[model samples]
Target: MTDGGAMLPWLVIRQDDNGNRYRVGSYATQDEAQRIADSLGGRGPERLYWVERMGQAAPS
Candidate 1:
């Protein structure tokens, strides 16, 4: 859970050349998530990485 009651709202998403998307990871802060995506970007030219903020949802 985070400051505004969102549980791991920051998401790191990856997409490959084949048009398949995957949830690489989740984070409490956007910066942390972006850093991870940036690091992964250099690994493959055909793979795309980005960060997104998911809707706020309370933890179970």
Candidate 2:
């Protein structure tokens, strides 16, 4: 997480086959984030994309 993305709470995330997650970008609405994620979807069988609300950190 970083500064500036605080206002836009929606996150577009990409996870590779190795299970490493990366933040693509942030949006003001979930729909907007999901649209970007969906556009990037299915590019590769091993790559996965989705949207999540920012500020909540997952257990490591």
Candidate 3:
């Protein structure tokens, strides 16, 4: 989302259930696993961020 600064098609995400801390990383694409994070975001998660590095379909 940074206009192709470091990489492209990254996964912007966070961890925990209380909307605490988070991180970002580049992903191949919007894989199905993204649904988990999407669900969390709908629950009032806070401090959301976007990634710009390589990442896997796992927890941040």
Candidate 4:
């Protein structure tokens, strides 16, 4: 858990066609979130998708 008392294991970042980025959801593990992101391939040039850790500012 993080300082906020919430689980900070994994996070999914997704971008919409309108150039808006946001957190899609959280996962118990990084691998779990990575699998979901991989399955959502080719979001398009206007869209972005990636997985990251809760406290991380960028995907590693």
User: Across residues 1-60, which tens digit of lDDT does each residue of candidate 2 receive?
Assistant: 445645788899888899999989988889999999999997987878888898776434
Question: Best-fitting candidate, measured by TM-score?
Answer: 2
The TM-score that candidate 3 achieves is 0.29
* Candidate of highest lDDT: 2
- Measured with C-alpha atoms, the lDDT of residue 48 in candidate 4 is 72
Ranking by TM-score: 2, 1, 4, 3
Q: Per-residue CA lDDT of candidate 4, range 14-58, in tens?
A: 887886778877888888888888877576666677998867787
Per-residue lDDT over 1-60 for candidate 1, one digit per residue giving the tens place of the 0 to 100 score:
355675798988888889888889889889999999999998876988888888643222
The C-alpha lDDT values of all candidates are: 0.82, 0.84, 0.49, 0.76
Pairs clashing within candidate 2: none
Which candidate, 1 or 2, would have the higher TM-score against the true structure?
A: 2
Q: Which ten residues in a row are the worst by lDDT in model 4?
A: 1-10
Please give the distance, in angstroms, between residue 53's alpha carbon in candidate 3 and its true position after superposition: 5.7
Ten residues in sequence with the least summed lDDT for candidate 2? 1-10
Task: Name the TM-score of candidate 1.
Answer: 0.77
- Pairs that clash in candidate 1: none
CA shift of 24, model 4, Å: 1.3
